[model samples]
Target: MKKSLSLILGLSLCALCVGTSFSQAAATQTVNLAVNSVQKIAITGGVITLTISNGTAGNNTLTPVSDATSTYSITHNSATPLRITANLDAALAAGYQLQIALAPGALMGTSAGTVDISNALAASAVAVVTGIPKGADAGRTITYTFNANASAGILTSTAKTVTLTLTN
Candidate 1:
């Protein structure tokens, strides 16, 4: 034939120009995502009970005529600044001691009692108050004031268990 039909029409026009140059060539890629920042807290008057009237032997200690307030109603979603601590899962027999404070105004600014947390009940955590100003105020109502000491003779009747924490 005419050179085999001109080499089969030049190999079918070079395979249709290499399949239309890879089908008109095209490619792309791009993706990204990120998010992080969390700190939450919530409290609603855990528990409170005090009945001083038994301190007399030698060192006697019983206070609760003025400072005996308790108020807690917080909710958090924190964005930063925050610090409220208190602990006493056990302890409070020998002599006795419990003098917490944070009722001065509220926001932890300080003033009223001046943030004094003595005895600490026991266990651990005993910060009392801090900056605490980032958000998560919610209902907002934190007032704590409890005083009771007995070292003189150390009577008897005693019970302690307090905890209200939120740190950052």
Candidate 2:
């Protein structure tokens, strides 16, 4: 009887160990993600000087002077197209004209070439770039032209503020 009881106890313990080894537990979780629209623009150079000191002989019109040393950059992620406009803080004096040109990336937008901003105002801004796509454009050229007719005569050194806007 004692031998038989010991054998039964050993078999029960082995079965318990086998059952525990086959058991398993598990866990789970959820995750989410998202992104937003963004837009930005910047200029790289400052204090460009344009002088009209020379003129063709017997020509009543003074030669126009230009400067293309400045550049602009942009980064945007918008669903729709966009544009860039330019204006001056105040209208230039009569007979003096200031023009601006912007070079867009090959795939970014259409360059308006050069547009005269001499009288452009906040309410009536001039468009310099149009049909801009969603991407980044770096090191784009910006050209400025200054012109004065002979009748306008010599102008004292003056300063003007140019405002460039990126919008839809």
Candidate 3:
């Protein structure tokens, strides 16, 4: 009887051990992602339509005038700072120069509307502004003035192209 009781106790303990509840802990994991950076610039209303007054019959010159204005927009989505510049693809007529100015309160890449790029050349890029922040669109209007010296030679009613290039 003693041996049988011991066997039964041992069996009961084994069963209890097999039925024991297990302690569990939840596991977690993390994932990370990133987006690519981009920097872009665009110009609208780039065409300059000019209507100049006629020169005096004896004077071979056209008066200086603000011919046209164009708007430039900078869409800076880059992670680094940016700058803007303007240059003319071709030189104006001899003794002539094209003047560019930013609006008084206009916003630039870094400054507030204070830029004048004169006698710009395709080989040289004039700094318009710097420090454009990263984000959406920022716009500025640039006014162009055409100046002609008295010795500019005989004037003709013809189309002259002065390309203004904007660069980052």
| Alpha-carbon TM-score of each model against the true structure | 0.28, 0.80, 0.59
| Preferred candidate (lDDT higher): 2 or 3 | 2
Model 1, range 59-162, lDDT digits (tens) per residue?
44555433333454444445666666776767555444565655423563332233434445445566665666654454344454444565444345555556
Task: Give the per-residue lDDT of model 3 (tens digit) for 1-168.
Answer: 999999999999988876673344457989888767765666667567554566667766676678435766656566666766666655556666666664412343554243334456666767666666676544566677766767766557544444433344
- Assess each prediction's global lDDT (C-alpha) against the native: 0.56, 0.90, 0.60
Better of 1 and 2 by lDDT: 2
**All candidates: CA RMSD (Å):** 11.9, 5.1, 6.7
User: 30-128, model 2: which lDDT tens digit per residue?
Assistant: 776665787888887888888999888887778999999999898889989789999999998888899999999898999998999999999999999
**Which regions in candidate 2 have their CA more than 4 angstroms from the true location?**
1-34
Whole-structure CA lDDT of model 2: 0.90
What's the TM for model 2? 0.80
Positional deviation of residue 32's Cα in model 2 after best superposition, in angstroms: 5.9
Q: Which ranges in model 3 have alpha carbons more than 4 Å from their true place?
A: 1-34, 54-62, 104-119, 155-168
